[model samples]
Target chain A: MTTSKQSAPISFERERPAGKSAARYILGRRLSRVWLYTLLIVTGLAFGLPFFWTISSSLKSITEIYIFPPTMWPAEIRWKNYADVFTIAPFARFIWNTVIVTLLAMLGQILSAAVVAFGFTRFRFPGRESLFVLVLSTIMLPWQVTIVPQFLLFRYLGWINTYWPLIIPSYFGGGAFYIFLLRQFFLTIPKDLDEAAKLDGASNFRIFWNIVLPLSKAALATVAIFSFIGHWNEFFAPLIYLNSTDKFTISIGLRYFVSNPFESDEPREAILMAASLITALPVLILFFVAQKYFVQGIVTTGLKG
Target chain B: MAAATGRSWWHSSAQRREALEGYLWISPWVIGFLLFALGPMIASLYLSFTEYKIGGSPVWLGLENYIRAFSQDKLFWPSLNRTAYFAIATVGLGTVGSLLAAILLNQNARGRNFFRALYYLPSLTPVVALAILWQWLLQPQVGFVNYALYQMGIDGPGWLTSRQWAVPSLILISLWAGIGGGRMIIFLAGLQGVPQELYESAELDGASTLQRFFNITLPMISPVILFNVILGVIGSFSVFALAYVATDGGPNYATYFFVLHLYYNAFSYFQMGYASALAWVFFLIIFILSFVQIKFSDRWVYYEFS
Candidate 1:
C-alpha cells in the first residue's frame, strides 16, 4: 500500500500561502528537503555500509581483510573463500538442515494456519468470539514462558537432537500471529462465495479447499515469506534442541565452526564472512524477489493492529 | 455473520451439524493450544513453586526460588536493572528513530523505495549473522567504526569489549538492525492513514509545520506509537540471541540481562525451579506493562473509531 501511497501532497491551489510567504514556504520545504537528504544519506549509509562491508569482505583475500583501514573494494575477489567454507565444516549439511526445518515448518504453518483461520472466519458457533480472543491472546504470550516445559517435553519424548522438535509444533497451529493475519484476510473474502458453494451441496471442507484456499494465495504467500525468513533466522530453539554438531542448523553450526574437527586451524575472517554471506543469501534473495509480500505482511499487521 | 445456516440457536439437526463442523475444523488448534501453550504454562507455574532438576520428582519449595531471586541471586536484581536500562534506551531511541525515518520516507519522490529497501536490509539478516558481523565491525583495534571515529579525532570506545559500552553497543546493534523495519513500516502506515485533508486544513488555518506535527500528526498516530512502544519493551526485555552471541552477557556481565539469567539457571546450572520463577516474573512484568500501557493509553492514544 505504501507504493505510490500518497496523492500529490494535498494540492490546495486555493488560498495557498501567498507572495513572500509562498516563497518562504517553498524555501522552508527546500531547506527541509536538504535536511532530509542529509539525514537519509547518513543513515542510509549507516544501514547499507555494514551490508557492503559484509559482502565485500566475504569476497576479500585474507590479506585484504586484515589491511589497515579495510579496503572498500577487495583488490582481488577470492572465490576460494566460498569454497573453503564448505571444506572447513558441515556447512552444506547445516544449510540442508535449516532448509528442511524451514520448508517443513512453512508447509505445516501455512496449511494449519489456513485451516484454523478458515474455521474462525467462515463458521460461527457458540463462544466463537471468545475462542478467537483466546487465539489472539497467545500472540502476546512470550515463547519464553512456555519454552522450558516445551524443552523438557521434547527431551522427554526423545525428540531432542532431531528435527521433530523444530517442525512438529508448526502443524498444530502455525502461530497466533499467522492465524490472526490469515483470519483478517479471510474475513475480507465475500461470504457469498461460500454460500454459493454450499448451495451446490458442497461440504465445508470442499468450499475451504476449492474456493477459499486458491483465492488466498497472496495472503498465504505473505505468510510463507515471513515463515521462510523467520525460520531461517530462528536461533534459539535450534540452539536448545539440536545439540549434536552433525544435526546443527546453519545458525549454530556457524557459531561452533571454529572448533570443527574437519579444520584444525582457525579459519580466516574472510572465510567466516563468506560463510555468513552464504547463510544470509537465501533470505536476501527471497526478500528482493518477494519484497511485496514481505512489506505487505508488515503493513497489514501494522495498520490492522 | 453467524453461519451459513443463519441460526444462533441449534434447534435443528443441521444447526447442530454446523456447530459440530465448526468445532471439528478448529479442533487441531485447540489440541495444539492445550498441548503446547496452556499445558506448558500450567506446568511451568507449578514447577516454579517446586524444585526439579530433571531425573527426580519436584520437591515442593513453596516460595524459596522466588525469595532467592529477590534476595539471594547476586545477578538477578542487577541483571533486571540492566535489562530495564537496555529496554529504555533501545525502545526509546528505536521508536523515535523509526518515527523520524517514517516521516522522512513518507515524502512522495523517486528513490524512496530504494531508501526504504536500504533501511530494511539489516533486519533481514539473521540475528546470529548480525551479532558476528557487528563483532567484527566493532573490533577494538581493527574495526572500521573505530577507524571512522579516528578520522574525526574521536577515540571510539572498546564497544562490545568495554564494560561501560557493552549494553550501549548491544543497544546500538539492536537499533541498527531493527529501527528501520516493521516499526517504521507501522509508523508509515499510521502516517498514511492520517488524512491528507487534515494537513490541508491545518495549512489553511496557518498552522506551522511544527505546530501541525504536534497538534495533528502526533495525536493521529498516538495509538500506533503506543503499540510500538509496548512491543518494543517486550521485545527488548526478552532479547537473547544478540547478547548471547555478541557479548555472552560479558565483559564482566555488564550486558547480562534478565532472560540470560533465566537461561543460565535453567539450562546451564539446571536450576529449573529458579529459572521458572524468573520466567514467571518476566511474564508478569510484560503482562502488567501491557496492562498499564493499555489502561493509561486512553489519556493520549486517539482511536478513530471510538
Candidate 2:
C-alpha cells in the first residue's frame, strides 16, 4: 500500500521531462501532423464504415443493395421504406414497447442497486460482507444455469408471455454487476462525512438521504446509462417472455423482417437496417451526454476488482 | 438531530430493534433472492435428478438425466468441446485485438476520443442486428467478406453453412463485437493505472517498446487481464443470441453452444429435466473455470491500490 504511493512520486519526476522530450521527438520526427490526422481519419472511417453502410443501404431499394460494385451512396433516399417497415409488422408498437420496458427496467435497476449498494457500504451488519460476495458471485453464474428453472418458475406463476418476467427481476437486483459497481463507489467516500452528519444529530437514513445521495451523482448517472443501454439492446428475454406482437420489444420485433428461415417479401434489408439504427439511437445519445462519468466508472470499477 | 449526540428518541432503541431495522431495509432483496434466485437454483438441482416436461410435475428418476446426457446424447460432448474451442479462440482473439486497440488509444494522440467512441459503437449494436449484418457480410456468394476474399483469389467457404467453418465464423463475429465492450474499456483503465514513471525508467534504461510492455505494462495490468478472461469464459459459454440470430445453431448443429442446447432441450424437445441437468453441468464448468482463475490470479495480478 505504502510502496505504490512512495514510488509514484519518484516515477512522476523521472518520467516528466523524458515524456516531454519523447512527445517533442515524435512530433518533430513525424512526416506531418496532417498525415497523422489523415491516418486517424481513415481509421475512423473504417470503424464507422458499417454504420454508414447500414444507413445508406436502409435508404435504398433492394436492387440497389445488391447492385454490382455496391453503390457507395444511394441515388434516391427512399423515405417510404420507413413506412413500409412499420407496415411489415407493428414496428411502432415494438418501438413503444421497447421504450416502456427499457425505461422501467432502467429505473428499477438504478433504484434497487443503489439502495442495496448503500446498505452494503454504509451499514454495519452481520451478513453485509457475505451478502456482497454472494452478489458478486452471481455475476459469474452463467444465466444459462438459471434459465430453465426461471422458465419453469415463471410458468408456474402464470407470468410467461408477459412483461412481468423480464421487467420484475431488475427491481429485485437481478443483475449483480451493477450492484457491485455501486458498492465500490459508495465505499470510496470518506467516513468522516458520515460522522459529521452524526455529530449534527442526523440519523443514518437521513444522512444517507441528504449527504450520500448528493455526493454519488456521477456513479448514479453511470449506472443509469449502463442500465438503459443494456435493456435497450436486450432481445433474448423479450423473445422468451413476450408472445404477443403488441408486447414485443423492438429487438424482437425487428426479427419479423426475416421470416426466421428466409427473408420476408417486404424490403427486409432496408427495414432491418432502419430498425437497427433506430434502436441504437437512444444509446448513442446517452453515451455522448454521459461520456465522462461512464468512462470514470468503468476504470474505477475495474480497479476495484 | 440529537441522534449524533446519542440523545435522539430513536437512538435509545434497543440493539435488537436496530438489527430488526437492518433486516427490514434488506428484506426486499432477501425475499427476491429466495423467490427468484435461491428457489430456482435449488429447484433446478432437483429437476436435474428427475424427469419433467414443461407441462407436468417432475417424476424422480435419480441420475437418469445425467447418465443419458453423458452416454446417449451425441450432441452433449461435441457441443461442450466445440464451445470450449470457441471460448479459447474468442477470448484469445478478442483480448489481443482489444489490447492492441486500447494501447494505441491510450497514447495521447489527437482525436483519440473520437476513435475510442467509434471503436465502441459496434459493441453497443444489438446482437441480433450485428448477427444479421454479419450474415449478410459472411454469405459465401453475396457476402462482402467473401467478395473481398474473392479478389484475393481465395474462395471463401460457406461460412454459415459449412459445418467445418461455422463455429469459427460465429467466434470471429462474436469476438469482433465483444472486443471493445469489456476488454477495451478495462484495458484503457489499466493503462491509466500504470504509473508514467515506470515507462520513463524503462525508456531511460534503454528498454524498447516491446520490452517495456512485457516487463512493466503486462505486470501492472495483469489483474485487468485476469478479470477480462474470467468474464470472457463465462460469456463465451453462455452464448445464445448471437448463435440464435446468426446460424440458429445449424448448418449441421455445428455452432450449437451449451446454452442453445439447453434451450432446445427445454423448449423445443420439451425435456425440462434433461435441460436442468445440462444447465447444472454448464454452471459447474463455469464455476470451476472462474475458481481456477481466482486461485491463479494472486500469483500474477498486481494490485496498485492495495
Candidate 3:
C-alpha cells in the first residue's frame, strides 16, 4: 500500500506549512515513522523467533537438549543429528515419497485445471453457466462431509495403504478454487489469437496446446506452485490412506517417531526437531521462491475456504 | 445456437457439435464429481441410517444412529461443546488480532515487503511440524516458555499435560501459527481497496483518527471482515491435525474435538454408522450457520456500490 519508501503513516500525510509550526509538524511525522518502524520490527522478530528456535534446537546434541535453561544456540552444532534422523527412521524414503506425491499431484492439477478452465473460458454450450456455478458452489462444502464414503470407495477399490488415493483425485481438476483461478486467468487471454488459429483449421486441442498454453505460463505456474505446497503439507489424506511404515510420508514418519513407545524417560527432542525441520523445509523454500505467485493466487481467487 | 425442434439425434449440427465438444472438455470434472463428491455423499447419507461396521453389510436400522447420538452417547455432546468453544475463541480472537496486524502493516513505513513475508512464514509451516515443534517448545520443565517463566520467579503451568490448560494452549499455538496468515493478507487487500480520498476528506473535517477509522474504514471493510470470519469458523471447527498430534485428545479428553471423536468412532472402533451420523450433523450445522450469517450480514456489511 505504501507508494514510496519515505512516505509516512496516513495520519501524517498532510501538507507541510511554511510557517514556524512547520518544524513541529515535521517532528511529529518523524516520531510517527519511528513508532511505526519499531512496532513492525518487534512484531517481525516475534514471528521470526520460532523458526530460529527450531533451527537452533535442531543443531543441539541430545545431552544439551534437555538442559534446564534451553540453549538458544548449541555450543557444538550437530551435523550428525541430520544423519541420525535417517538412522532412527527411513526419513530419506519419506522425503522421496513426499516428493513423488507432490509432483504427480501438481502435474495432474495443472493440466486438468487448465483444460477445464479452457472449456469454461472458450466454449459456449447449453447449461455452461449453471455448470460452472455448480463447480463454484462445491467450494463451500467441507471435505469432512465426503471423506468417509470416499475412504470406503477407495477401500473397495483396494487402494488403501497405497499412493493411489492420495494422487488420483488431482487428475480430476484439482479442486474448485484452482479451476476458478485458472478460468479467471484464461479469460484474460485475447480471443483473437485463438480466432486466428481457427482460420488455419487448427483443432480445438491444437489451439489450446499450441496457441493459448504458451501465453498462460504464469497462471499455470501459479496453479503448479499452489498445488505443490498444498499437497506437500497435507497431513490428513496421507495419514489416513498410507498406513504402512514403508509407505510413510514425512508427516507420518515424524508422527511415528514421537508417538512410538520408548523405555527412556525422555524422547529424543533433538532428533524430532531435526526431522521436523526437514519435513517443513521444502514448503518454506517454495514460499520464498514463489512468494509473488502465493500473493497473486490468493488475491485473484478471493475465496480460500 | 441450433433450433431444438429441428435437431435430430445423429445429426451433427454446428451448435450440437460445439456443445458435445464442451462436454468432452469438462468430462474430467464431471467424472470426479460422480466418483468423489456426489456418489460418496449419497453413500455417506445412506450409511448414516444403517448399522454398518467395517467389512459388514449395511443393515436397516432407521433413526437408531441419530437417536443414540442425541440421547445415549455421553462424549458426543461434550465434544461438540468443546469444539464450539475452540471455534468461537479462535474465530473471535483471530479476526481481531489479524485485522489489527493488517492495519499496522498498511502503514507507509519502510521494509514493508520483508516484514510481510516474515510474518507469513508461520502459515507456510506444515501442521505436523508445527504441532511437534510447539509440543517440544511447551515441554513444561524443559520448554522455552517455562524457562522464561522460571527466570521471572514463577512456575509455569503444565500446558499440554494439564486438562485446564489444554484447549487454551492449543488456541495459543494456533494463533501463533495463524495470526499473520491468510486472514492478514486478505485484510491487507481489503485495506488497500479503501479509497484514500475518504480518509483525506475526513481528516480535513477535523475528525480524530479513531473517528475516521470507525466512520469510513470499518464500514468499507465490513464485507471483507464477514468473509474472513466465515472462513475462520469453518477452518477452526474442523481442526483435527493439531490436537491429534499435540495432545492426542488426552489428559481426560480435555481437547477432544468433534472431528477427533468422529474419527475415533469410524476408524478406531469401526463405528462407521455412528461416525457417518456425526458427519451429517456436522455438515448441517455448518450449512445452517453459514446460511444464517449470509442472511444477516446485510445488517452490518453493506457494499459500497453493488
All DockQ scores: 0.40, 0.35, 0.39
DockQ, prediction 1: 0.40
DockQ of 3: 0.39
What TM-score does the first chain of candidate 2 have?
A: 0.84
Per-residue lDDT, model 1, residue A172, is: 93
Candidates' chain B TM-scores in the order shown: 0.96, 0.92, 0.94
Please provide, for model 1 over A1-305, each residue's C-alpha lDDT reduced to its tens digit, 9 standing for 90 to 100: 11223322221122322332222222235446567678778889999998888888889886778888778889998999999989878899999999999999999999999999988888767778889889978878888899889989998999989999889999998898898888878887899998998899998889999999999898899999998888999999998898888899999988876334443444377787788888899998998898777767776666666
Leading candidate by DockQ: 1
Across A1-305, the per-residue lDDT of candidate 2 in tens digits comes to: 01222211111112323334333222232335566567567756656776777788779887777765566678988877778777767778988888888889888888888777777776555565667677776777677777788887788789988888878888986367777777766777888999998999998888778988788887788788888889988987887778887788888877755644334454367766776777677787888787776676666555565
> Arrange candidates by lDDT, highest first: which order?
1, 3, 2
Candidates arranged by TM-score, highest first = 1, 3, 2
What's the distance in Å from true for residue A76, model 3?
A: 1.9
Candidate 3 on B13-70: residue-level lDDT in tens?
A: 8767887898889989989988988887788899999988889899978999999999
Report the error of model 3 at residue B21, Å: 1.6
Instruction: Give the poorly placed runs of model 1, Cα more than 4 Å off.
Output: A1-32, A258-267, B1-8
List where candidate 3 sits over 4 angstroms from the true fold: A1-31, A262-266, A303-305, B1-12
How far out, in Å, is residue A170 in model 2? 1.3
Which model is ahead, 2 or 3, in terms of TM-score? 3
